[model samples]
Target: MLKLESLVFDNGFARLPEAYYSRVCPTPVPDPYLVCYSPQAAVLIDLDPAEMARPELVETLAGNRLLPGMDALAALYAGHQFGHYVPQLGDGRAILLGEVKNAAGEGWEVQLKGAGRTPYSRGGDGRAVLRSSIREFLCSEAMHALGIPTTRALAIVGSDHPVYREDVETAALVTRLAPSFVRFGSFEVFYYRNQIEPIRQLADYVIARYYPELAARAEPYAELLREVARRTAELMAQWQAVGFSHGVMNTDNMSILGLTLDYGPFGFLDAFDPGFVCNHSDSGGRYAFDQQPDVAAWNVTKLAQALVPLLSVETASAAIGDYPQQFGRAYIERMAAKFGLPPGGETVPLLMDTLQLLAQNRVDYTIFLRRLCDFDSTPGALNAPLRDLFPDRPAFDAWAARYAAALRQQDSADATRREAMRALNPKYILRNHLAEAAIRRAADHRDYSEIHRLHALLSRPYDEQPECEAYAAEPPDWAKRIEVSCSS
Candidate 1:
């Protein structure tokens, strides 16, 4: 055992009944090595910064050894995979070492991804590749910097051991910190099994830990479902605004806190295409870009069904019903911010219709939005910018006349709105081409400088970093149509 006293167990989920989790230690690996440790995570966890970089600390984090007082266990929860129910799916590869109350006094589950197999391993070897580990580290931090709630990565540890996939690769573990690892699938597992007491116990545990205010309500369980819907809608709206595609919308992958969790085969849209599908395995495009909002609602509806035992039929349906209106309001607000216009019913729909037209004409999503924010008082002034995103100048000129007329009716000055929109709209996104280039260099040449640079650039994506203007440009030729999938 490492050292238990220095360790604190605010053990939120562990407080739930025995069926919800399996108490198991991480099966240690061989020849563990440190890859990268985020000092920011150390600060978040309130661990000693110097100790976090220590060799022994790295070994413990890599699953080569156990930390002192670490009660590592794999959580048990089932989820719906692509709209199909998996009665028992849990942390196959990940092990929650324990919970720790950070300096802020907020409890966070500190888990080791790729730690080794647990009861939920499902006959497959529990391992993670270095590439995926690196992506998770960078993307988690990048999202957090972008003001999106997400599970944070404390460190990524690579081991000498190799694993087989399409090819042999080194193994790695990501130390993930989050308020809870419980998913929508977790609730689904017990409901499908008809385990009512465990469901109530788990719901109470969640309300106490994360949604404390809900505990005061007359019907905490029903209120919990509604609260989840509200948060999920807001989260989906944020994803839409940022042009992020989660790639996999499995119920197990959805965090209850409305934070982005899994980073497998995910991509940021470099060009605006509403139907953009990132996951190649998703042949039906069930989780396509435009379909995300609906998919999120669908997943939450499953959660609502699971909670029906604890909630009245009317309450459950009412919670589910709020999804459309909630998502609509949140999405419109986000879109309004992107265009620097205060949200109103009429202008928002007109903007949405205009977006559809642009999509039909194959407009560059980020570039078109950014350029529209910079137009002068007259329609003619925006011709060049509009034409750049359209097939021909005349096609854009006609659209620009209508767009300019709409803008002139607003009270905000064109310059002020432009400046405001610039703040809301990002100049840079983590484009697939750029990410691939960074990953390839790191894998082939052991160069992390480019990766580090890209991470920094994405941190403040909305700002115009004059020296880093090239980083804001769209992907070059040969980079489009690249397929990212759920496999890794």
Candidate 2:
């Protein structure tokens, strides 16, 4: 079991030169308490799940106490936000508590969000409010449950201390776990500064730690670029297939390892609008639902530019060249599995038509997809309830006929297909309203049961969870009024 008192941290990132980060101790919050935590995440570092309830875990997470071997500091990096390049933007409010190995001997970095002021704070109050913290904490775990790669939330510590956002709200800190928090922005900051050595050093460090297999390659740096592009394409495809809009696809938010790194202003597709902008602050809809793949390619290109000093321009360009095909292939394969159809030309059009059908009808993406698992190849009265979901019966009939034909061609059995599709198309997603509901009870009444309830429900997203079916229902009218931004 991982012990809070004696857990040894061997921080690889900290071993890099002082130029990569700012050594800063986390500023403590007042009267902190555990909001909720993930037992699954606690197990990632091989800690006993019961340990999450202990006071020391909450204290350490709340920045109230520093544990042994914890080399606390904030990362320094810059990125392009909404397509505009910012020369220097770093961890303004987060402090890395250093890294430790799990039972499998994998190093995981522990980080605290809303841990207070750093050199990168830039005159703003470096504290995260409970509102956004709940969203991040829940969604991080929720994404992982859906079989998507994302950073894990270990715990959330709520504080009575007030923090200002749109309103005066209480402070909260999230303990996020990841293999590495290194982003495309990490290399960008050095490149923009016209410093070659730091860029090379950062690249070398990343290669050694995460991409060690590339060490002996003739052009390891170029290979790193290709691998990043490939992984990023796959990540974007996963996001798209699941109807997830990251809201902000900033280079800094884009993980170098292709994990869903940051969780700000994110939303899942409620009504299948391709132009859905989850981040209200994004005036131009730059990171829209349908545009995620294209934006990801754009971000990968930025990472390629950052690596120009380490490899030839020709090699770097070639590395990112396959992004479109990579994303297309991965997306179709995932969508095919969600439809329980093997990916091929025949299934490709069915998937495209499904998207068109969903977009045209403005259907509840999750519900419609989940219900499709029980699709009958021989449609009859059995499909009436499914048919009721579409506004236009004719449109639904046309698509249903094609889908049925595809299933018949594959000789897919209803029982087997239903099981496969149900596993891929989750019954539960972190809908904005559901997250809002959890945040409300936790913030307004100081009752965190909803937070605990949500973490449990989302952890088994693919399961039926018949008792919690209300969570998988269509969003309410009040959900439309909810607007999240770059704030928090």
The RMSD of every model to the true structure, in order and in angstroms, is 2.5, 1.0
Across 1-488, the per-residue lDDT of candidate 1 in tens digits comes to 11323656556666666788898887677877676666676777677667765778877888877755577788888888777888888999899988888667877789999887889999868888787888888888878877788899888887768877778887889999998888998889989998888888888888888899989898888889989999999999999888888989999999888889889878777666898888888898888899999999999999999999998888898877888999999999888777666688467777777777777787767777777778775745755755777775676676677667777777668877888888777787777777777777867776767777877787778788889988777689888767677647
Which tens-of-lDDT digit does each residue in 1-488 have in candidate 2? Answer: 76666577777888999999999999988789988888899888888878877887888889989887888989999999989999888999999998989879899999999999999999978899999999999999999998899999999898989887778999999999999999999999988999999999989998999999999999999999999999999999999988899998999999989999889999999998989999999899899888999999999999999999998899999999999999999998998889888888688877887888888998989999898988888854348767888898899988888889888888989998899888899999999999999888988798889888999999999999999989999999999999999994
**How many backbone overlaps does candidate 2 show?**
0
Question: What are the models' TM-scores?
Answer: 0.94, 0.98
Q: How high a TM-score does candidate 2 get?
A: 0.98
Candidate 2: residue 229 lDDT (0-100): 99
For model 2, name the residue pairs that clash: none
TM-score of 1: 0.94
lDDT of 2: 0.90
Q: Pick by lDDT: which candidate is best?
A: 2
The superposed Cα distance between candidate 2 and the true structure at residue 144, in angstroms, equals 0.6
lDDT of each: 0.81, 0.90
* Error in Å for residue 114 of model 2: 0.3
For model 1, name the residue pairs that clash.
2-68, 3-68, 78-185, 272-365
> Which candidate number maximizes TM-score?
2
